[model samples]
Target: MSFITLFITASMPILKVLLISALGSFLALDSVDILGDIARKHLNKVVFFVFNPALVASNLAKTITYETFLTLWFMPVNVFITFLIGSILGWILTKITKPPKHLKGLVIGACSAGNIGKMPIIIVPAMCKEEGSPFGAVDVCQSYGLAYASLSMALGAILMWSYVYNIIRISSRDVVVEICASPSEGFDDTFKNSSKQPLLPSADYTSITTVNQSSFSSRMQQWLTTSIDKLNLKAILAPSTIGAIVGFVIGMISPFRKFLIGNSAPLHVVEDSAYLVGEAAIPTVTLILGANLLSGLKGSQIQYKIVIGIATIRYILLPLVGIFIVRGVVRAGLQLDPLLQFVLLLQYAVPPAMNIGTMTQLFGRGQSEYSVIMLWTYGLAAVALTLWSTMFLWLVAS
Candidate 1:
């Protein structure tokens, strides 16, 4: 089947669900019955701490051999280039399309090249080993792709910050001050507009008389007063950040290296817990994606052109970009195995992320729009991706 035909056929059933929900939303019927917030909320938490951290932890776990480090260095460079491409394309496309001024931010904000975290079903099938194999082996370096994705996360940060920078980049200051001043970008705190809070006396150890004391006490009080800011960057960065610290300590204790993953004690409990939470990542995201879809289906002033453009870029252009990148890498005589090629291209095609909707909701943009676009993006992505994978079977494993 052709890409469009395969996409539409594969997507029709899912399309029905979305259409009904969108119609219901358009009709102003209660959407929460069909759509629930539970999934979004749960996945938001998991992504923030467990899922994202595990991603970082797992990717960074192996010793950074010269070979791996070389790959790591190029990873950021690739993302910086990809970000430039994505941002410029999105900006120019938005300009020509001329969405509303308020929605200009939304349009650019809503679309992205891809997410750092892998969507295995979307990617793996396109890259899996062929049905019959001599050794029953498929080169699956999930970590390598994921590591590149982590850098994608940083590049994504820079891109989004560039957008937000439009709103706040007046006069810069010290790096530490800027980090402290950066607005909350993740869930729960995206809507924060104020920088001051009622000081919890416990979290802040200060006396009332200190307000009238010497300049030293006054400075201390000022520092304490001003320091309370968004806790999310710390929250999201903490798990992996802490994990790295722990991993380093483990590395230093070479004598005890065997004890941790060894046969004797087996840190199986901790291992199991991480696996369980990490496993929850995908389904939790899908469910939230489902609910977000239901809600969006309820209401939208969607431009069909934008939808098609996003779908085309994600399933078509994005992978093409990857192919170009891969060809260049190959032409340079770098040996990137087949699975890696598929994984890299697949990352470029993975659907618009659900976390974006969460952030949009927190920022008080239209929930209706957020939900609807997600419905359309994921729905079409299902088909667009399938066809792309099938058509390019030579690069694909399965």
Candidate 2:
């Protein structure tokens, strides 16, 4: 395809996201009152807990087999590298910009977690349907493309829930601690002074020292317990994670796979139902994403430098690094299909995951800042993705 043609083809899906998100933003307005804060919150809960898991489980169960899994083994590794490199870059950004403590994780997450799910799911198939796609026949390309997209969604969800989730969770907890500690500082000093008073005559210095040591040890243990509790492993192993696990089990285990997945299977109806529900996941998520972006328009105290730093890392640096990494892998003698290689390369160039907004809503911290970041990254994605897709297609096809 000509560069112009490729750019146009690539821009279409991104335009769709932009349009839908705009609708959501409009609906969220008080005058519209369609996707109000309460409605968006409830819809987000449904997406997070229900639609997303069903979508992941159904897609994974339908598409993944042990053979296909082995063939696509590099995908997970590629995704990990994206997260790893983006995270390192995010940390550097944090050190340089010094955003508020609560926003540090949001920044890191925005840097690290690409929009692996929806972008590919929408863009790749659309590209396949275009006139000059390099990925061969339309039906075959779409089939393979959707499979790749599905796997990306599943793995991305798992990582987003676990890695990104924890980073934001810990950062939010730190905010909580700071808020709580500020008011108690004077009380804490008074308590410390009283404790420093001379002990009763009956209590010898040796005995007092032993009591202090024991009390210190107990406090340490209690602190550890509190920290562990705050980790909230339940949030990490969210419904989406559980769904992915179930999908993998059904996908990889022959008997289970036979029982639930194929059309000929006795219980295929259940899988079909799940698939039907899963279809709603993308539109729902995009709508909520738009509504969240409205929050960004309300204005925030988030620094412009931090926003620019995130945009630069995600759009400029990550994509360049991805090209090098994918080429390096090929040079190292691990052959990949042209389409698969393109997908891997494109993975590095996507905007931040929409799930970050959902997570911020869940934690009730950094929502406005995250929304602003999302608005900027996604707004820029139309041009960035078009340009990158054109280059990637040229490179891969050549």
Candidate 3:
């Protein structure tokens, strides 16, 4: 596809979703929280555990290939880069705006949040599910899942650790252990682990708006205590490590591959549900965003410049970078399928995860401002994602 067409394809999906959502809102069918509530109660659950896990498992079940191996490392590399960039940008953003130092972390956290879990789930299927995607594209998740899983391990751990360490001022070891123990950390516990619950009935999206100093302080204290109480690396890694090692070992044995994959094995389940739930991940994320909007955020927190910069990075810079990387990978003899390329492209296209706001809150950064960033990015995400998907499809088609 020509550059113009590529952009058009990318932009259309988001536009369609937003246009429809706007229509829905105008019709007064539901409030923001109402949508969020529906997402949490219905979509979030089915996707997170059932869909995401199946997706991850299916990707992991395939035989290891050189291309898939390399794709595995890309995400952590991106996360590390994003972290450095976000920190530097945070420093710069804080210097120019001069919000209280106490609040500075929020901006970094917000800008730095990557769509770790959702990106792969949503992206892998979209681009690869079709014929002539990057690889045979049948196994596009091989690329997306590994990258997602690798980064899921890398960044999820880092984000959780950063939250515990900076916010609680805890020992590094303790943070690692806590993250490993908590299934939310990606690997260690990962999405496949039954240790944690992805969608909780107790959740209250409205509470996201309670972002004042007092609330921040309260959260910090809670984080510190949790970190202190939960540190246990051996125990934490035991379940997931065992599951991963045994599954991979059995898969490589060949005789077990088909039988195991078709059966009730965790890996098979991961793939089955990941494709299904992955579809819902973005919408669920959008609802999360909508919930915050309904919570009544303020203007001062939503700086226009920051919002523009973030949107530019998310919609523009990230995908452009992915394009270059994809071309480089293909030229450089990586042999990645086209669908995988699309999924990788998608990994970049997603909005920052909710963790950005949480990290800001936990660490005493620009909690207010970051929360606002999350709000706008996600507000735009529902439509933005659809628009991007359409653009991607057209790009490949052309």
> TM-score for each prediction?
0.63, 0.82, 0.57
Q: Which candidate is the best by TM-score?
A: 2
lDDT of 3 at 95: 68
Total clashing residue pairs per candidate?
A: 5, 0, 39
Q: What is each predicted model's overall lDDT from 0 to 1?
A: 0.50, 0.85, 0.51
- Candidate with maximal lDDT: 2
How high a TM-score does candidate 3 get?
A: 0.57
Give candidates' CA RMSD values in order. Answer: 11.9, 5.2, 16.7
* lDDT (Cα, tens digit) per residue for candidate 1, span 301-381: 867677666666666766788778866786798765554555456556666655555455555554566577677777676
* Residues 1-398, model 3: lDDT tens digits: 45554545455445444544454333323533444445444654564344444434444555433444455555455556554554555457656766544555555544455665544444444444434332444554445444345335334444534442253222111233233354455565454676665664545545555546569899999998887655534332432233344435444566666555555654566445544543444455444444444332554555577677677667666656656665566679865454544555565567766544444444454555665676677676766676666555554444
* Tens-digit per-residue lDDT, 1-398, candidate 2: 67787667666767787888899888999999999988987897898788878877887777778887787889999999999999999999999999989889999999999999878877787788878788899877876776677778877877887789889988887433245466589789889999998767864878989989999999999999987666656766777767778887898899999999878999999999997887787788778778877777777889999999999999899999999999888889887888888899999999999888878888899988887887888888878998888888888887
Candidate 1, position 175, lDDT: 32
Off by over 4 Å in 3: 2-51, 62-67, 128-256, 263-289, 296-302, 312-335, 359-368, 379-398
Of the pair 1 and 2, which is ahead by lDDT? 2
Which of candidates 2 and 3 reaches a greater TM-score? 2
After TM-score superposition, the amount by which residue 368's alpha carbon in candidate 1 deviates from its true location, in angstroms, is 2.3
